[model samples]
Target: MTKQNTFLNDLRNEAITGVAYKNLMLKKQILEYFANISDATITDLSKGLNASIPKINELVVALIEDGLVKDSGKTEVGIGRRPSLYGLKSNSIFFVGVEVKKSHVNIGLSDFKKNLIKSVKRIPFQLTNSQASLDDLCIIIDDFIKSLALAENIAGIGVNLTGRINYKTGYSYSFFHFNEEPLSVIIKDKIGIRTYIENDSRAMAYGEFCSGIVDKEKNILFVNLDYGIGLGIMINGELYYGKSGFAGEFGHIQIFNNEIICHCGKKGCLETEASGSALLEAFKIRLQQGASSIITKDRPDFNDIQLEDIIQAANNDDTLAIELIAEIGEKLGRGIAALINLFNPELVILGGSLSATGDYLFLPVKSAINKYSLSLVNNDTELKMSKLGENAGIIGACLLVRERLLELK
Candidate 1:
């Protein structure tokens, strides 16, 4: 090659590397500033990072170029000149969140701020336990992205499931036919973007944490009472995935020695007695006994009875339904008390479909915890309902993608 061409190529390479380094530094500063405070002025950020005014300006310009930060106009104080404020631009990018449940999958597209833009729900039957089924899921995901015109704009995909997950290696041991196949690799290979997998309950807990609630509590636990019970633990503001990433499998803990079997091939697990499926089973037995309950009146077709129907019956003063829920709540509380004694978390947020019953489930749960737990531990721990509701999984998934990308920087 000619001397001029070689020198020009070297200059171009140097420029690219310089831009990459500056971008990385700016991203780091933006994440650190946002983590420490909700908002910042360029002057404040400059002073905090010990960077010069011109350098700060350049960094902010680069951040804006990357769509990671934005200027929110000038803030006026009571007395002096107005100062410009900067904050993370939550809508600069988008993520896709997939929640894989035993019966169905919920796919949601969300912006960087974790706001759901669009969602699609598909039954498990549509996939039907085959290789082609996995392809179908990919098609559905692709369709959802195409619908939103986000095929090129998406940053990554997040998978939330009710099973053991290895975020580092991207393997899911608990759900699907290819138990050992890395879910992240499969999705990434098909979708052409990064993919992350996390336990559903833990994802919900992280969603709540990221939402800025429970800021005062560094140690918290989220109990999900769904098709089966699950636990999500956070300590010192970080999700605690124990060795093998199966730390919060609280549903499998044995609370009774009864002969009743659990899905995990165990007997008398906490979920066997306290989960929504268990409650539904109990409701069915009582209904068959000619129990006087409003649920029976509402859904004469026993096959159609749902968790909400029983909750509604209890709300309508159905003695059988109310008594049954209280019993399950007591059992759940006992399991919660065990958690309190073990971890001594500052707060326990009850989530999942059963939590929809509100105080109908919480009251008895509190009573059981108070009755069974040591006074010191009980006093420090507060039981509350999850603020995120069903959207928690999707939001948590988006947060996962954001967190991973930030870590890369």
Candidate 2:
């Protein structure tokens, strides 16, 4: 591959002479520094990379010529000549982030500077357990790239997939089980772009870490309360993928003794009682049992009453909706309290559509956490709703592409 298309290969290990290899390594280091801090001076680069000022300055000039960086501005100073600041060019390279939701697909484009340049959300795409679904997804992605005309400049495509995924190997144990080829490999081959597939929950967690209220936090747990419940485990400031790379299946924990079957074919899993799907089921059951809701006032069949409609009704003071959501929150909090006891994460950010209910879900969760968790352990865990909201997976996918490209995450 040519140096211009560094997306398909590691930028630091290109076939080059010794002098060029050294220069490439130095440039890679400089790019890392710029990624962490948007702008840096020559002295800052030299000190950070442990290189001389002249050498660092030389590479910075080359990077500018390559269109990877630009002069942001001069560092503000009152006493002496201000050093110029170099920053990653916002349009130099791009990453495409795709989130495969059960009901829709979310695509977002992020620049080298991590700004989401454009996005197309809520495209009607159903993720079923079939090869046809995978083909449809690839076709949509191809169309998206062609429409944007970013096939050549795009660095990578990150897909946030739900279910059992070996992120290290890009092999999915669930869904799109058509071939022996890893999902990432199949996608990369089809789309002609370097591709990565990550668990939706873990992707959301990493996204929250890089872009959320995380302020140098080292340990975190991102709880995805979507159609199904899932967990993203982070320890010591790194995403922890356990043996076989399928660690964060927090929903399959058998918490209750009911006969309800989970999506994983397990009985009485946490998701059976505490997830968005569970909430929907409970809402419908209550309506069938003579409970009333604002949505039911118009349509008694309750077939169209989705999770979002219930959340909206709760927001509008629908008594039945609020009660059902609070009950789910209480159950979810019980499960989370167990997680707190186990992981003791410093921060827990709630992500997914179900978390958008705000205080309706949060209050009950907090109450349950306080009631069930050890005082010291609960005190160590700070729970908050995701700032990125439903976009966490898409944004996280974009950021992960950059992180993997730079070998920084």
- Summarize candidate 2's per-residue lDDT along 1-409 as a digit string, tens digits: 4356332243523366687777777887888888776589999889888999999999888888767889988888746888898888778888999999988899989888778888888888889978889999999899899999767678889999888988778888888867889999899899988888999999999888888768877899999998899899999988888998889889999999999998789899999999999999988888888887889766667887778788788889999988988999999999999999998889988888888889999999999999998989989889999998867888899998888866654
lDDT of 1 by residue, 293-348 (tens): 77666688888897767877777777887788889999999999999999999999
Q: TM-score for all predictions?
A: 0.83, 0.90
**CA lDDT scores, all candidates in order:** 0.78, 0.86
Write down the worst ten-residue block by lDDT for model 2: 5-14
Clashes of 1: 0
Tally clashing residue pairs in candidate 2: 0
